[model samples]
Target chain A: MEENKKKSPYKNKAEKDALFEKEFMHLITPLYNFAYRLTFNEDDANDLVQETYLKAYRFFDSYEKGTNAKAWLFRILKNSFINEYRKNVKQPGKVDYQEVESYYNSDDIDEPITQDLRVDSVKDLIGDEVANALNSLDVDFRTIIILCDLEEFTYEEIAKILDIPIGTVRSRLHRARNILKEKLREYARNMGYNG
Target chain B: MIKTITHLIHRLIGKKEHSYCCKNCINDLYLVLDGEAEQKQEEELLKHIEKCEPCFTRYQIEKSVKEVIKYKIQHKQVPPQLIHSIKEKINGII
Candidate 1:
């Protein structure tokens, strides 16, 4: 029948609700953490995570079942952040991807600093300094670092989440880490770590 | 005689020196750390790290940085209310 064809594959609403709860609810902690890091504010992070979940629930039909729910949710949250907060509030002028790419490429300064043992060791560095240094980075760089280092996502996963090629993920992560190391170097030196 | 035996033992345990500087291993350092490298590349990278000091140090530092980020950044706990609210929102809709 036409009605039968329109119906979802789910046997009942109860089954759908239970499955959604089991799979998606558990990801709240990680989702919020990611949201917080991206927005750097409690209110924004809360709104972001809420918006992400709302969107996910609305589009639940499109989500392929039995796949990576975490990655799926993460992708939604990341895209929402880019479209909503990043474009509207952060930049009045449109974010020029080309300009950002060229800016990253123009800086060859990170090469010498990282190779020369400028920071000595990050072992003794305090949490505040690390957090500061991390937050200081541009959102693009920071997102990659958070995804790769903090969330421990693989490059391929990151490439999928960021909608870029695997090669871009590699190069961007390399550049991001180098920039992070440079930022940490100043803090390390301030802490009197001379190596 | 004892030194020679110890050296032989080290080599037996896969402690042989790396003769050539491998560009692939060096380039894929973070890839290996992030568990993104292919199986064969991972093996080659581990071997290269064992023999190369610079690569080993680089690996250590990157690993340490990862750990630090995971440890410190995770302290931002999500409030209990937020979870309850999200549940409420979902419950209302479903």
Candidate 2:
């Protein structure tokens, strides 16, 4: 009886492998997008996505069948981004908007020598310049913008992803957007637009 | 006389001119813009916007900021070589 139970056709390792492959294949694009946005570098993003997939495959048995597979995979990738990938990178200090405002307000700044700067339209402003500004933001601000604005994740989901309170998610998203707006405004000013 | 007095009191308190969206509602405009407001709050905000000019303008600015940021993110294309490399890696694994 025990031998017959062990020999059941449904228990085949190859069948399980096939099932995992089918499900895992469908999640690759979103996983790649998430990693790319987080790392902002192609090679690093690729590596992160690859590692996430490998880790998921190794632990496939632990995943519940009917639950959200994408969220589970994203949780893994987010953890990897925080614990492993971000460890080697240098994070900037918190932005003090007050200090930034005071510095820019100082009388030592030179006035614009020419008023001939051309303003680019929203379409023209949406490329590398925007990406560079996003990359330049501190990781905290960048992650909030990525989760809340770009990914359109709910504040509750973002709280789970970042392991912060929901209120923190809301407040951080607000601060992040304000900072991004300030940066974009600066870019607009340089292009001679009245932001 | 009593009805006239009540009317005068209402006008004196500026209830007729007051916006439906109060300070708290204005503060929550970002959440509304994100589509993250709870259902009741969302409904209330919509009703408020229908009557209030200042709050309506605030809503427009928030909406514009969201659109501009979204446009910026959407326009950023992943490099072709990166796509090729990812495909190659997936094929190798398969």
Candidate 3:
């Protein structure tokens, strides 16, 4: 049975179309939003979303019906973003490691460590501040925050989507939230939220 | 000397569940707040929070943050044209 399953071909065009329409089309808005946040540009986001959908349609047969179509589609989109978009965006900057190492090895690395404990209650954080804080995060942290908070995906779903263990998801989410809180603390304090 | 005495006194007084100073419990608070902790663990954590003021405050703050993000991010209007084009593009492909 397992051998037969391995040999089985993907869905036919008609079936693929039906499945795509029924199980996957509804995710366009959220998927595009995710893409937009990741790329932070409209055209790039659009391209990523379009590419994701095309790839999803092409690989429709492997998807298990009646079981988390959203996660499956998200997984495909995330892979497309990592493989296609991230590679292209990061490829142009080739840093010289020798120079970087020499600088770090010298006595000039004045990395300051300070903790800001000035605010309480994120309740006063406005929408724009929230968006800014989210956007300012590194991609890994931002992705986890978006998945867990904005999209309301469970940790298990996030683990599956990001292809990481659940423990990593929890730790990353904790770190991400801490970072976001620190970013928003200034805004909260500015609004005179003492508690 | 003062910090060491405080630590020794705390150890002698036996850590109370009502004390909000347990770092371990506070670390697990987010999972409980997010509803990711298992039922048994959830009950244990909730019980701990019931007695711990700091953990409860942390819980409320984190919950509000989650709510704010969810409310703000999803409120952006997805362009109708974008949706239409996506449908068209998918149809054009297969």
Candidate 4:
């Protein structure tokens, strides 16, 4: 089976089109999911998906056969999202890490770290809270979380999609996950999850 | 001084999970919990979790948080009319 796939000449236009039609339906859910994660809204996701498909169809000839079709599609969709949607959204102000570190360091050393402190009494960690927390993250952090955590892209794949070094992808993903974990922990505490 | 050196050595070589599991590993834990960790790193993290309780607990917590978020996102369904309109637009473009 693997050998057959290796030798297949689905590289030609007619064969490619037939294969695309046969396989495109399988991509709809994934494409929709990608769009939805990026836009965080249904209408925008739909629009993005439509645009992605249109663009994908136009550039169909450019695609290398028997390669990662999904990643290729996602790359196109992500480019569109950044160019069209993200460009319009005003980015949050940058954090001054030095100041933040100084502020923390200035605090009393004897003050207990709340390694075990309870905050509130809500049981369910609602989605809005999660979304809001994710939204609060910088665009870099947010994109890493969406791609790595939600979409399950590999570090290598994410690097390709975002056009960054693999080291950058790893570091950003780590920082992003840490941020989300901290926020979710706070949210969990607010909702009263003691454990 | 010897005792203090021993203490420092214990702390340095402690059973605690690495403070730097890298962002890729941390984020990958979510997919791991969802039973979707990729081949190579999946084995690596699985071995790490076998001995690292802190990271294991962290994995559980991250998974739970993801579940809550996933539930919320799934609940926010797009309206059928909107979906229809988008489909119409898509067809028109094609």
> Best lDDT goes to which candidate?
1
> Top model by TM-score, which number?
1
Interface RMSD for each of the candidates: 4.4, 8.7, 6.1, 6.6
Question: How far off is residue A164 in model 4, in Å?
Answer: 1.4
The 10-residue segment of model 2 chain B with minimum total lDDT is: B14-23
lDDT by residue (A35-93, candidate 1, tens digit) is 98888899999999998888988877777776688889999999999889876774555
The CAPRI class of candidate 1 is acceptable
For model 2, the superposed segments whose C-alpha errors exceed 4 Å read A1-10, A90-124, B1-23, B74-94
Model 3's chain B yields a TM-score of 0.65
Instruction: Summing lDDT over every window of 10 consecutive residues in candidate 3 chain A, give the lowest-scoring window.
Output: A107-116
Predicted candidate 3 versus true structure: per-residue lDDT over A100-135, tens digit per residue: 334433522121101222324465566788898899
In candidate 2, position A144 carries an lDDT of 74
Per-residue lDDT of candidate 2, residues A1-195 (tens digit): 344333433366566556766777667766777788777777778788777877776677667666567767888888998788766665564355446444433521222211221223333465566666676777777777776776677777788877888976765665566566566666767665654
Q: Which is superior by DockQ, 2 or 3?
A: 3
Chain A TM-score, prediction 3? 0.77
User: What TM-score does chain B get in every candidate?
Assistant: 0.60, 0.57, 0.65, 0.48
DockQ of each: 0.30, 0.18, 0.29, 0.18
Tens-place lDDT digits, model 1, residues B1-90: 443455457669966433213445546777677877789888878876776665676777777877778786535788888887887887
- DockQ of predicted model 3: 0.29
